[model samples]
Target chain A: MNVKDKYYQEVLRFWKDLTPNQRELVDHSIIKKHFNKGEAMRSSSDQCSGLFLIESGQVRAYIISENGKEITLYRLFDRDVCIFSASCIMKNISFDIFIETEKETTAYLIPTSIFDKLSKESMAVQVFANELMASRFSDVMWIMEQTLFMTLDKRLAIFLLEQSNIEESDTIKITHEKIANHLGSAREVITRMLKYFQEEGIISLSRGTIHIVNRKRLEQLTLY
Target chain B: MNVKDKYYQEVLRFWKDLTPNQRELVDHSIIKKHFNKGEAMRSSSDQCSGLFLIESGQVRAYIISENGKEITLYRLFDRDVCIFSASCIMKNISFDIFIETEKETTAYLIPTSIFDKLSKESMAVQVFANELMASRFSDVMWIMEQTLFMTLDKRLAIFLLEQSNIEESDTIKITHEKIANHLGSAREVITRMLKYFQEEGIISLSRGTIHIVNRKRLEQLTLY
Candidate 1:
């Protein structure tokens, strides 16, 4: 398959059970696009632009506070679908959430009008869409539980471990400030925690880097 | 219409655009039941029971920590549909959440088997279900924002304002413990905040009740 067909196939996997007519509607509705790292895909002021399906690379969905603090709600990876970006189509969600490309990303955008059309015609498409929404909801609920019940240190440890696994390396290239933003905390708090972790020989920090020296100990800390 | 049909009508409003055949499936599938106050509707150990459509009364969805601390995710009032309770039907959500009836609740329960069949055949059913899921996700995301960005005082103020409106009275008949449970804060923290609100003349406290004395001040506090 050519590049365009590849992207089309990526989205089709989610709706494999869709009828031929339903699939035709989806194929006609999607608009494929590319976004470079650090580019904003959707912002607070934008209406429901469309649903985004990440074919490759990464997208970070986050919200900023009125005082300018940022908290990452969740991240979308390859083959992930984001419906919140199409907020205009959803009546209940009105918060100022911004979607930014975390990596050079190629994605498929389905306009709200087409999405509504597909939703009105296909049960498979609707089931798939509802599952996507539920998964995201579960993510947000997990975040709330972590923020409300889990301590910052445990959360930081867990985040680092997850990042390391994602990169498949003990060395993680991330700054304390970025980590702070992701965890919805102050840079100073993250720095303090990192310093404590280093002092305990769990990690070693350098300019814009965190190296896990003792993965076993770090994993233990995350358990609490 | 008989009482049974009346209950079916309550759920049909959500799927008003559904085809006649789809409506027939829904009418045949729904099992209406009543739950007393403080009854557990679904627990972590239970499998996805079914989608719950609240015809009347209230349901509280919450999670309990390993340490036994409880934080409510959100509440469902009359005419609300809770899909999370039917988690088995949705493959993506695996979190352990409990649903409890906060008031004497009369509801319609649609089994996952019938729900899947209906969703597979009707676009309108699918759209309505997706909307319900999206609405709940928005509610949880809002909770995350409130927990992470807003201060205890502001949240408490907003909660009080909302509670007053829900009860349709200036005086809210609720205990500090219940309020803490709703906001996912310590009872002591809630007590301290209520005392502070009283000192500030925003509210007056009595046994099992709180009277909003200065609605303007409370509203102003929530804006922060």
Candidate 2:
């Protein structure tokens, strides 16, 4: 089947209650796009791209501080939706976010004008859009809560475990700098913490990878 | 005029395009409620309280950690709309937020059932609701960015400047514990920082208030 047909079966299936007119608008405006890994797709300061419904692969949405520190807001995987890419259509959303393809990603993009039109004219589109926005808000709030309340060690522990789960391996092929960027910490701090963890027999670090020596200990660090 | 009519003129005036049926639904189900200062209006673990359209006074929305540390997400003032209070209606929103009256607050609440019905049936209601949600998301994201990227001194300086602007006075009638809660810091840390600020001749601290001694220096600190 063609990409549009595939999109219709995958993304449009969620909006089964949409009117014929609304469906027509989506069909006429939707475009399928591909990006290579590490390609920058959108930035908060750039023009708005409409909603993205991921068909495959992965994307990381993040924000860069004035000082050039970056932190991940969230990640989008297969079948996930990114509404912030089209944030320009929302009047009150002032902050900008950056989106980059973490892997070779394919997604269906609904242009901003079409999304703005449908969100105003169709209740189904509105509900879908609002739910996506609310869910994203919850995620951003969770990141904020962790930053505000949790110590660096706990957050790093949680991040390592999460990375292990995502990569489905006890050894994570990630650099200390990369981990620092994700956790919004300095590289030296992360390195020091990792060394301390190594001494505690919880983890062992190689040149560019970390292998969990005691997964239970790492898990316990997250709890404490 | 009665309270309901006042609410119609004040809050519903912005939603002029709402259909008569939608208007009737809101008008019938809308309730005007008053909250005394310091009253806990809603918690994440409690029942959803629908949407709040502030008529007067102030409300603070915050989240509490497992260890009971509280951090302010955002504040709602006159004419501000809070969509998270009715987050229960949105299926994918899993986080709970707590709302309390920072001052004696008067607000008109749209019942969740009525709001859900109208949002599904009326495009105007959908737009209004979505805009509110998007705006609140922006606020929460701004908070997250501050927590992740900024130093405690910079955030404290910004907070003091913001409080001065809001109160229209250089002397803020707030305690260190309250400031800690708002900035998501410990009382001792806040006290130490306040002492530093006082030593720097930026501010003066009393038993229950902070008086800005040098507004220019405080502003410069935030810029730095």
Candidate 3:
């Protein structure tokens, strides 16, 4: 099968029980696009770009503050579906969110008009949309809980551990500025905390990278 | 019309274009209940309770931290619909949320089985459910933004102004502890901030009430 046919199969995986008419609608409406690393895929001010289903690589969804600080709401990887990019169809989601490619990525785009129509006509599509929405809400709520209730040190510790898990390496190749952006904190604050962690023999920091020296101590910090 | 019939009419306002079969299903399946102020309507550990449609009074949905601190996700007033109470049906919303009455409330509930069936059969019902979920996600995102990006003093000012608008009075009848709970901060932090605001002449505190003495300054504080 061609790449387009394979992508169509992937789409069907999400709505496996779609009726013949719904399947035809998706086949006619779906579009595929590729994004380079660090590319802006969607913006709050732009026209609603529609729902995106990641085929490969990853993308990050985040909100920017007035002073330009960014806090990631969540990240979508291969086989993940994103609804916030098409948030305009979802009534009352007024706040602006931006989606950017974290790595070279290819994704299927279902235009808002088609998805909206399909959702109105197909129960399967609607259920998928609601599940996607509910899951995103849970992600955002988790981030809010971390920001509100946890101290900066604990949050940093958690972030470091999470990055280690994601990279599958003790050495995480990320900058202090990037870490601050992820945690919605200042770079200097993150730098100071990293210094403290290093002093406490929890983690060692090198130029543009963080190495977990004491994974157990870092895990202990994340506990209440 | 009786109260139950009146609520049925209100439900129609949401799914106004429902077909006869859908209307009949809702009429027979909807359940009505009342909750006194401060009553616990639902908890994280309880079974799914389906969707809630508030007819009168108010309710708050929140998440509790491991250390027992509570952070409100959002609140529902008259005519508002709640989906988090039926989160189990959404498939991926695994977090625990608690719902409690903030005021004596009368509500209509569509049990999970019926709502699930209706949403599958009726496009109108599915549309209404998706809209309800989207609106709630937006509400939760707004709170997360405030918690992550805004300063506590600014958030407190915005909260006071919002309370004044809700009550249509300059004096807000709430305690520091309640404010802390809503903002997801320690009571001592809120108390200290309130004292600072009092010294700044933006507000005057008396007992459990806070009077906005300088509305202009308080509003200015919320501006970037």
Candidate 4:
């Protein structure tokens, strides 16, 4: 099925068991809008409504470090949604993360107040909330384990294997600086590693681009 | 209110709210039990019926690494409950961590089937699930941040402070080896840092015990 159709099916199924009045209430509470490339759905200190769902295009969620470095933790692609984090919206609390559109995007933003009302009143909404929380928690745990147990080279290899030719038509087009920031390593170290990989014929890097020429060889190198 | 009274009140309010006869259905599904000091209530690969609420005494949860080292992640004390974790009850999945009592303890364990049934249909049960997810996520984030950013010395300082008797006494009896495992560092590093702190008059260590001589100094070191 197409992405839009899949999303529509999901929302419909989520609200399928709910009464018609409750579903209508949620639909009315949702606000749909378009965000341009480089636009922010929400950033640090922006009081937002409830969590948002990414309907189309790509968005990045990142935090800026004390040294003025941006750390992109996760990318929110189509069909994914952000829920539970009230730091950006309510209480006027400061959040370190920025939610920026990587391309022109369309999203649905739900008001948290009404969301809570729905959750407090509806078992269907409560189940949806619990499932979303579990996913978010598992995502954080995965990131934590990656940072702790995985070496930089293994991390790079995993990222390459996961992203290569699988997403975005086999072309990542990511910059060295962004890769360094994501891996929490020095750009020089990445450059040196890439040079080694090139000599080993595992990968080729040229002009802000990296191409995986040999997947099996690359995976073997990551073992070290 | 007394702890026992508080427990019944909270549980009754939440569970009974689902239906007039909800407590009757749930009460028959719960099993109460006691565990002795230094005893494991749950272990890796041990599946149980449901969640355990620590009604009395203390329990520590830890994960054994591939190197046969146990990493301490959390200490559950009075009034806290373990729920929604596969480690607590899920079958066919190895427990991510083990739960053992530090002292003779009483806990109320609920049956998973009943809890699962109610959770899918009951708003109160879903709220409980949501809270558990949030709490676990916070814990994973704390441990992750420590592993990613904090140095061994700083982590050791925090550990000492946490274990120290700050209310009346200023001593910590937990061994340095235990602290090392919790901080994910070597015993030699902990030993050296303790010696340094002792020389600085911030602490004094003697034969399996550490006593804080300067509270302000120790706090300063931690801040550093």
Give the number of the best model, judged by lDDT. Answer: 2
In model 3 chain B, which range of ten residues has the least summed lDDT? B7-16
Candidate ordering by DockQ (highest first): 2, 3, 1, 4
Judged by whole-model lDDT over C-alpha atoms, candidate 2 comes out at 0.85
lDDT of 2 by residue, B107-200 (tens): 8898888878776766777777778777788788898888778899999999999999989999999999999999888999999999999999
TM (B chain), model 2: 0.93
Write one digit per residue (lDDT tens) for candidate 1, span A29-83: 7788899999888975665778888889989988888788898879989988878
Off by over 4 Å in 2: A1-7, A19-25, B1-9
Give each prediction's DockQ, rounded to 2 decimals: 0.64, 0.79, 0.75, 0.31
List the candidate 3 regions with Cα displacement exceeding 4 Å: A1-7, A11-14, A19-25, A44-47, B1-7, B12-22, B45-47
Please report the candidate that would top DockQ against the real structure. Answer: 2
Best by TM-score: 2
TM-score chain B for all models.
Answer: 0.89, 0.93, 0.92, 0.85
Model 4: fnat (fraction of native contacts):
0.24
TM-score of chain A of each: 0.91, 0.92, 0.92, 0.82
Interface RMSD of each: 1.7, 1.1, 1.2, 5.4
RMSD (CA, Å), each prediction: 2.7, 2.4, 2.5, 3.9
DockQ of 2: 0.79
Winner of 2 and 3 under TM-score: 2
What DockQ was computed for model 4? 0.31
Against the true structure, candidate 4 has what lDDT?
A: 0.67
lDDT (CA) per prediction: 0.82, 0.85, 0.84, 0.67
